[model samples]
Target chain A: MANVSNETRPLSPHLQVYRLPLNAKLSILHRITGVALAFAAILIVWYFLALATGPEYFETASAVLTSWFGILVFTLSTVALWLHFANGVRHLVWDTGSHLGQKASNRSAMIGLAFMVVMTIITLWIAIGG
Target chain B: MRFLTDRKRVEGLGSAKQGTGHFWEQRLSAIALLFLVPLFVLPFAYNLGDGYEEVRAAYAHPVNAVIAIAFFVTVSLHFFQGVQVVIEDYVHGRLGMILIIAMRLLSTLFALIGAYAVIRISLGA
Candidate 1:
């Protein structure tokens, strides 16, 4: 009541003050990855347009994507993709009414994190070698 | 005929069903992408860096073409939904409304261009 009484009273801590839990961390990671992938929408669309354009344009797009910077971005995007995927699965599971507790949430986050790392590693290996 | 102030109307604007509709869309596309991504990405990665004709031949298969189109549409829709949530959370006022519409247009563009590309290659046009 006292806190509500004064408009300028000290407020609850925000992002700066709170040390977020593992689940919270992974939850935000999901949003970040989503945004990253949203941007990659342009790249994927570009790939298609380039292919449809002609051989020369396709080659140019291919070269740009296979370049070092492109590879770096792709790697990060792929990591984000898997991160989002794994956490998304966690969300699906949670929606089913299981894994709803604090401890369980953290454990699930760890599992999802592990899954993301393994999948990302294998995919990157294939992407690089193939 | 009921005339209500803009503030009164919008302040309680939600019909309550909108949230469920949004959730359903998000989940449905998510489930679709769960399958479509693997279907689309595997062949795409496999064909990456291939010659134009070779890639075109791969996409010429109806299955590949269909998957490409479905992937594009679902991805853009899901993206539009996700970015709407993002923008709503981070932005406010008329600017937020404008950005939401922009995201809609952007998603539509992504779907259109992607389908066009796939269709052209698929038909050998």
Candidate 2:
């Protein structure tokens, strides 16, 4: 708002107004996953808090986390965690002035997607004692 | 235009004076997390269903303790910066400012609590 006018300007096409390409979709997904991970930080913090609080508290937290619902949420969070990390690395690569074109972006998107898929599966497998 | 000395002209990032610094903080933290996440999460993930004593033992290890501390401290900064940008983009006016302030306070508290919890657990105190 600094030094900006209150005059309403022509808005860009609404998100629902048009179908977005994979690039835009992935870009938004990066933000979504980042936000997801932000909230997911709470899960880790709670574990530490419970652990420091004592055995009873730790056991309670552990039980809740290992519950079906908790596992489900954690699984989703893990997906988000991996996607955000992979896509973020893509962004960092772009920041270095490499892969500035759509083709390169698409290639990295494919690579990142593959990495996230494989890693998430392996991680969930190990995590769930599978 | 405001008159600037040579040093200020060259050293200043932009009109707002914070152009690249904020960007750099985000990037640097992302780089740190790039390493720290695997170092921290891979082990923690395996301990997901384990009991309290095992969990405590994991963090009690000095390397794990240090990594946890580093992850929390670094992530507080990253989280604050990331969410602050989101708030700025989506929130506006007085409410936006209020949320940003509140978020800053919360992020600081998060780091403090994380450090405290890890240190206490490490010392078994």
Best by DockQ: 2
| C-alpha local distance difference test of each model | 0.85, 0.87
Which pairs clash (backbone N, Cα, C closer than 3 Å) in model 2?
Answer: none
Clash pairs, candidate 1, are none
Cα lDDT tens digits, model 1, A46-104, are 98899898889998888877888777778888788888988888888887899999889
| Candidate 1 chain B, poorest ten consecutive residues by summed lDDT | B10-19
All candidates: DockQ: 0.50, 0.53
Evaluated at residue A30, the lDDT of candidate 2 is 82
Candidate 2 lDDT over residue span A56-96, tens digit each: 99988888788887787788988988888899999999999
